[model samples]
Target: MQALQSRLQQLENATGSDIWNILKGSESDLIQDLSTLNTLKEDKEKKGREALKVLETKKKELKSLKKEIETLRNEYKLHVEEVEKGLKASGLEMSQVTKVFEKVLEDSLSEKKTKILQIISSMRDFKTIPELHSPLKSILELLKDPNQEKLRSMIQIDLEDIHRQSMEIFRQNLWSEFQKQGIPMKKLQETPNPDEFLQRVSRIFEFSSDLDLLLIGIPNNRIHVAFGMLSNICIDMIENEKERDADFEWILTSAHKWAKNLREVIEKATERTGSEFDEKFVEFIGNITKRFLKKNQKDPLIFTKLATLLRRFEDTCEFNLTDKDIFESLYEPEFISKWILLEIELFTLSFNQLLLDSSSFDPLPSIFIGSASSSTWASEITVQFEQWISRVEKDISSIRNPEVQTTFYECLYALMIDLCSKIHVEANRLYSEASWSNHVYLVMNTIWELRRIVKVFIFITNRERDRRGKKKDIELAGELKWPRENSFLKEN
Candidate 1:
């Protein structure tokens, strides 16, 4: 009994449980467990015997498969021998025939490869698409053979090269033809009739249309050269108008009309070729527009012209030319920084002119006293303020990016506040002189008029924004923050 209890304690320790309690329960339970273990041992031995039988059957089938494979190998050897005998009877060996056939195919492809390379090299010398027709057709014929798929792939690179060179040559020729016609000569100047200008422009269309028929079945052969040239001409004319001092309204209208004519000419060309006119023309115009903008970036008048140009394009043309498009083209960090600073220089000139004009004001009429009506000096400054707002709005209304527009508004607000601060400083200087009391009063009235104008400007702009269904986010900043606080300006 002591030995069995010691064994049961060992079992309890090994199992991590008090099995001795269950073991101490009944002898019938122990007898049933022993029966279940015996049954499981028998079942495992039976499964092992069945697995051995399945292994024996698999070994027999594998041995039979080896015999069948040997028979097949013998038959394959006999078939090869018969084929070799047949080749010998025809005065040909398998190895020799294969080498000869491979040589012929290789030589043929090499000759065609040389021809393609020659054609691509001489692409610039070729005058028309017809010059490319016979050689390209012959090379393409070999590409149609199913047996020559490898050969086709060998020349696919050359074919793409040809397409690129050909299109480049086409673009160059189109540009040359535009230059030849003197297309941009006086197109910038106002004319009673533009039909005569477009008539000369129609010559390039004829040239492109003649080649369009020949380029059928050729991939990536759409004629965009004319569109590109037209875009260049339009931009050049725009620059010309600016230099010629043409009317601003005319410049804006002419930009839209230029786009309209561009669309019409492109549509006419695509109709001949049965291809879709993509945004390539817009992109081309954008490139030229960037160059134009950069050239005139130092001139403040370009800003007003560019703004009005964008407005006219959006309002008139279905073509999507957004402010983002124009902004991105001119958005190089250094260029935009210089452009913004240029505005400061322009304002300084205009401000100096205003001061000069005010200096010349007769002392008799410039006299001021405390009254309900605004002083003459205040009236003149407010009128100038209204004009500045109008000019700024020309650019502001054209700015579509909300964040950029807000930044520009802040810039304008800062300029106004700076002007007020300067006036205040001058008033302080006047107050130092006891006889200049009326001058100080006039300057104070000017500040009050500026404040009134700011209020009216905010009200009108908010009403416009509300009508347009945009958020009324325009506001003022300073100690007397009327609409919103500008933390950036406050920091400055």
Candidate 2:
């Protein structure tokens, strides 16, 4: 019993040193106590049984303590791991910067704002926008310390407010500067020296690039500001040009220059932001063209010039298009229909003027003594019809769309038939019986020439359709429901 008591005293002393360091020593002492308890178990004395029971109780207690120490150790390990993870996430390490940050947190709001502005200004030179947030994140981490909880809340709120106000003021100043640096599309157009205008454009591009770099902290700020400024400049130019009734060529050239240059800028601005400007630009152009079209619907040259300009713009800007689409897919079939009808109206007007200028179809009674072949003799109307057919062919050849060509050809066929009917009626009324046969030959000759012209146009139109892989039949004379005389020429 004295030996057991001695061992117990030793175990207690060992345990008192340090629980972590004494666990193994305490276990060794417990093992010796177990050996002594086993040796004393056979004594069969009351003190022996009591000693055995006491040893058993002590063993239970020590086992329980071991479990508790193990649980505490595991908990400590987890706590250390969590602290390491938090430090890593905060982009900070155990360093003296924490003490410095503590002092910064104690500064006045104005002083803090100044410091933040200085940090931001310095960080603006960072290679990437995301990298600029590193220093700010470190500041945030220092602010998150639980020791400065109240101070953290107050300072964070103040910093946020300061940042918001500063960003707004900064953005406005940058915007004002950007506006001043930007040369409007109208001014660029009016600039007679192409080299000077190009230099100004280069300067604008450089400014846009610098603005993008300066506004790195605000995501997409540069994109919005630059796009807005360009939008306003283009809109202003459109309004000014419309008011002045400027030539379509001028409007188109100016629009093209802006679009080509701004496209590259928009691409660069949106590249890092993962935002799209294509739809926005397309919508912008749609609106501007809509306004221009509304104002110049009566202008005869708008159709051809607008078509050429939009095709070039679409190609240069990488705008999507299908076979049936044109003008960056902005204008639809309805617009093309209007253009076709306008062209037919103009053709009719010109044809009417031609008739007015040379009203007589018969040969004048001029005494020409030169002998001529009677078979080769042709009326002035036949010559006029041939010349008119050549002009019509030239105009139609300039049209690229096969469907539009087919539609125009059909309308023109109807027009020719109506005009021929009138010519037949007029000839019957004016010619005497003696000249009736000659007049008939001359009229038939004109009809024959018109028939040849119609065949040639059909062949050309069908060949175009075949080239486009369209199998739809276009019977210009027979299949089409021809409009009444002069009815198709009316405004829709």
Candidate 3:
């Protein structure tokens, strides 16, 4: 057992006997664990290297993507700028083309007519030219050729033929339309007297003539044709006064239809694109006034017609008063003077007639006659005559030049003298009548006042003439002064 103990001690010394041997076994297990850990670390290092290679590849791809995106952005910006330049250039070209088109339309007459017709037809489809896709421009380009005129004239003739056919249908349809509206043909046919109906129809013709001349701007040639027809109708009516009233009514009805047709023709003429007919119409109106004067001679109808014409002139041309052409024509001195003289003559005739027949004198006639004869009776008439005289005086005063003023004054003086002579005759007739005895003192007193005022006016005018030393003015003054001076001396 001692020898066994010694062997065991040697074993213990070799491998740490007694629990040391078990510990040595555990240490071996730990060394094996360390070896396994070292193997795992080496495997982990290999995996790390693989992951680094993948990251490098991904980084290169990302850089390429960023460069591509930048290149694409630059290309897009350049494309947008080029598109904007193209749009601006196109807009400028369109504007230039439009201007060229308008010029062509204005200068080329044949082209204008053709294009206008086309435009009118197109208007049924579209409200405006723009909706027709630069139609005006295209039409203008087509019109640039010289053959457009011949084509236009041919087209016009064809259009007229078509219009004639269409108008027949239109008239028939219009008659039906009128019937549907319940307008009576019998009411339109009612006749007064043959002579009276002729006169009434003449008045309507005159109205239409004036309208055509002053308002519509019809050609002078057309005006002459229309006026001649109207004159013939008037002459026929006057010469055949014994004809049946129905005959006159039929003629008048025909005249109305003719006037309607003429108006339509004038309207069509005016629609021609470059036509300027307003001036011609004005000339035609003047001619009509002259013709009416010639037909009536010195009859009161002449003055009445002239007054009617003046009123029509005012209505038609007043809106264009500021237009230089219209103003010169309307305010011509000779025309105005003639009109004033006619007005004065009308007043004179009516005044003398009223004085001669007091039994038949109405209040209006008496008032007008009395006021015209003497300022003492001015209060008797309506304010209208007084305003008219005041306006006339203002118009006369507006003539600044001495020659015109003197001439106008002389004409007025003649009118005044003629008026005074008529008044004198009326006064003599009234004084001779025994029935006027009760009002005799009042009449004499008014006459005396008027005579005195007239004398005073003459004296003042003479004084002005003497101061001016104008021979014509002096002669007028002496003529007026002698009458009043002699009349006053004779009364005394």
TM-score for each predicted model, relative to the true structure: 0.52, 0.43, 0.29
The CA lDDT of each predicted structure is 0.57, 0.54, 0.45
TM-score, candidate number 3: 0.29
- Of candidates 3 and 1, the better by TM-score: 1
lDDT by residue (1-492, candidate 3, tens digit) is 343344455566464364565555456555666788799989999899999999999999999999999999998988867766775767755456568886775566655666656753653454321343344344445545566665445455544443333333333433333233222222223323434433433433333333232212344333344334444554466456553232433443444444444433334433231223344334434444444444444453344333443544445442223332322332356555564676577556655554565432222333432344455342221223344344445454433345555665566567556645544555456667787564444444444444454455455555655555643432222222212322522332
Runs in model 2 lying further than 4 Å from the true structure: 1-177, 183-232, 242-246, 267-286, 308-334, 352-409, 427-434, 471-492
Kindly list the per-residue Cα lDDT of model 1 for residues 1-492, writing each as its tens digit. 344455566575554345655456545656666678788989999999999999999999999999999999999999989988999999889899789988997888777667656655665466565575555555555455444556546666766666565556566754664455443232323333445544544544543343343232453333456556655665666566655434534544555555454455444434443323335535554576576676666566776676666566556655554333544454556555665676666766766566545332123355442354644444566666667777776676665555566556667767776665545445555667776657655655555556666776677666756765654564552312211122213333
Maximum-TM-score candidate:
1
| Full-model lDDT, candidate 2 | 0.54
lDDT sort, best first: 1, 2, 3
Q: Which order, best to worst by TM-score?
A: 1, 2, 3
Residue pairs clashing in model 2 are none
Q: Candidate 3, 111: how far from true, in Å?
A: 32
